[model samples]
Target: MESSVPALPSVLLKDGELKDVEAKPVIIGGMVLDIHATPSVPANPRTTTPGKVHYILGGVARNVAECMSKLGAKPYMISVVGLDMAGNLLLEHWKSAGLSLDVAAESGIPVWFEPVSVVKSKRVVSVVKHITFASPNEDELIAMANALSCGEVFSPIQKDNKKNKCSTESLFQMLRPAIWVLLEEGIKVVVVTLGSDGVLLCSNGAPGFMKGSSKGSNPHGSGNQLYRLVNSSCPPNRFFSASKFEGGSNLFAAHFPALPASVVRLTGAGDCLVGGALACICAGLNVMQSLAVGIAAAKAAVEVDTNVPTEYSLAKITDDAKSIYFATKMMFCQSML
Candidate 1:
């Protein structure tokens, strides 16, 4: 979200005709073939256990675009999926969805970047310096912080100690330096994803984020059924800030709990989470609503083997997202140097 990779204008199909609007939002990243091998029973790592293997279309960017498409936005993907069997599968599925394969050289759309790893995550320092939003895990967070700081400034937290298991509060404190670095580097929002514990959304007091409405979508006419449903469920109960709190007085951070789910595989939870949020942002929901919707999408991902749920239930997403959005609270908001 460095500038605005979202705010996808509502493009609806009415009476078998395409709605008048701007070009489709563009997504730049990878189109990879994901091979998943699951064992039927617990066994030693040295031996392969009897399990099922399936080939699926996956890539961080691809997953996000697919998720956005499922949520009702036709995003033009910019990535490398060549004329091979795997590439054809990826393209065919996207083509089937009515998503555009067209790639524009530069559209100036807002960009949202996800760290691929601890090392390569540093490759996008320039991107970070101008990024409006980022979601980095623990190691990647520290790495980006180091690159931003122009030095080795952080170390991994040791979780083996029973007395110092790095609880949420402590984790926040430890990563606060890193978060501070990212925020200072012009990154507007830094969402730290903690497995099971949920997410930490930190910001350098970005405008409209903690206020009235930060929705990114601009609807044209009636909009689609799904996008309309999406807009209705946003602006969480507590999205409005009380007058008592001084504006832009402190760094902002909030915690959202992970929804309870029947476990399957966690391989795609984080990817789907980003996908869901990006989709909502494009659909015109504010950050809180979008994140909630994203989490709901992730819940769906964990329930199924696919990186993204084959189909999303707007009703179910709204219901589950409302709970998360309402329950979320600003856990930290104080001036910190």
Candidate 2:
């Protein structure tokens, strides 16, 4: 028997309002989780508040999937969530958004989340204590252990006490095989957004990187201001000195180097960027064009204070693309030797 998971047959959305409209083409599959936390509102000195709190569904996969749905694309999420309220909330949202949730893995683990607080006056002065993960089932654990022995599984190196340094390898292990199945099923475009490095596109094993601008502010205000000052004061053309690469893709490629912004809030930007890129692809753009769209979308995301802006506009996304379009064109023209 083949070791491949069968693709779910396409379900037509026949709801009265959307029946006639042309459906956007795209399927984003991955994990989704809730983020519950209280942000520190830094004052003149330094203090903490104990009043209101905020909670939202936020995972890299969730963020991108929701963003794509909002942009009129069909995003299908596949990952584990426990049999708890958090899981229920996630499924409810996905259903409401008109996204496909055919392959979701409902784990038998706890679903509650913990809150965190950041003292810095950057994005949201506070942070989440940690993210909640669904305990892997027996099959998942066996599969992960098996893949590890074969060198098909690897974990991110520990980078100190930073929250971002924690292991996401568990999620990746689940995603890899599912995505390979997606590839075999004619989904040629597959994107994995690595926070600071940029995005990774895989098709027919020809993977590439999209370099980030490294020029961004924190998702909030103060740090964002600081990044702007640094960029303005520095010599104009020296912003992207860190980028060195060649492009020109037959199928898969990356373009993070095109971004020269300082990363601040590193929260929903990756999702927004992926959504933007996918949207561009749905709009009939190629790899270079999609990178421009994705980067611009990330720029739009970082320029906001809240995680998901209510007024999430795409104009800045367009402007950001225009700013780097020529540079990407040049990179694509160069051979990757």
Candidate 3:
């Protein structure tokens, strides 16, 4: 008898929905954990408030994966968990939620509390080296910025003078060179998320598109080209030349406003936004449309306590995107005035 070979898994796209996608799983690599917390307002010092304690699945990357799974996308979790009951339960929960955990591994449980916060800090200089190695989205970029500016990460400015002001703009300016360096590594898009202020989108060109000269002479060259910033919501006539490289491509930048929404808790909103945006992208939506969907998902996420969204909530986010899309267009037009 002849030996039989296993068939490779395939992903299918239909009617703007990613179906039966076993191979093309959204790989989320980060922390994963079960969070136990007591609800307390103002969080009185040294006093235990009378409130109901609850346990929930929590973690940046894990939450993102769960939200993506809820939004009908196959998400694969790449995380380390402790060899304990909590870890076992967390893994079981992920399995029940239809998330793929083949990439997850066993390790020590990373726990934290109010007084003792998680202290996973790294230098900005070192972080930039890792970030430029891959194409990270807006939320991930913002997280890095937060880590750098919050005094958690070591900074030369902080070392030189503790009183030196460290605004977000200053940090971005400092990191601009690092962002430019990413271009040499084939990174075409750089998204910066500004909470409530909105998102700043920077791109050299569409992903996978060949770099060409703006003069319309050659179709392909040494990957050096001029790039223009086009507001997704603005009229086609409006365009801004961001910058140009001598023998490379330029970077384009644009800002989009955040949609208004009611808030109950802001725990997993960013994760939801990232997950929703990625899912929309996988479903073949354009960058702007995917962003709009992400904003809508975040709006929905803030209204709920749980990080994992239900199917109904995901559908509601899709419905909310329609209105948010128009609102963004109006906001973009007003900004141009």
lDDT per model vs. reference: 0.68, 0.39, 0.44
* Per-candidate clash tally: 8, 29, 2
Per-residue CA lDDT of model 2 for 125-232, tens digit only, reads 121111111111123322332332344353333243665553333333334453343234333334444454344444433322121122332231212332232223
Expressed as tens digits, the lDDT of each residue in 260-297 for candidate 1 is: 99988787788788877876665544567678878888
Worst 10 residues of 3 by lDDT: 108-117
Model 2 lDDT, full chain set: 0.39
Question: Which runs in model 2 stand beyond 4 Å of their true positions?
Answer: 1-33, 39-52, 74-84, 96-149, 152-264, 305-307, 329-337
Per-residue C-alpha lDDT of model 3 across residues 1-337, encoded as one tens digit per residue? 0000101121111121222222233343454564656665657779876666677788766776677666655655556678787788778877522223222111111010000011332223243322211223333443334554453332222212447645444544544543444444333345555566565554443222111111322121111110011112322122222222112344444455677777778887767777666555443344555666777777788877777555435345655765555554211111010
Q: State model 1's lDDT.
A: 0.68
**CA deviation > 4 Å runs, candidate 1:** 1-4, 7-23, 39-51, 95-108, 160-166, 210-224, 230-237, 242-249
Residue 65 deviation, candidate 3, in Å?
1.1
Best by lDDT: 1
What TM-score do all the candidates reach, one by one? 0.81, 0.45, 0.57
After TM-score superposition, the amount by which residue 320's alpha carbon in candidate 1 deviates from its true location, in angstroms, is 1.0
Off by over 4 Å in 3: 1-23, 34-36, 39-48, 96-185, 205-248, 327-337
Sort every candidate by TM-score, greatest first: 1, 3, 2
Reference-based TM-score, model 3: 0.57
**Best candidate, TM-score:** 1
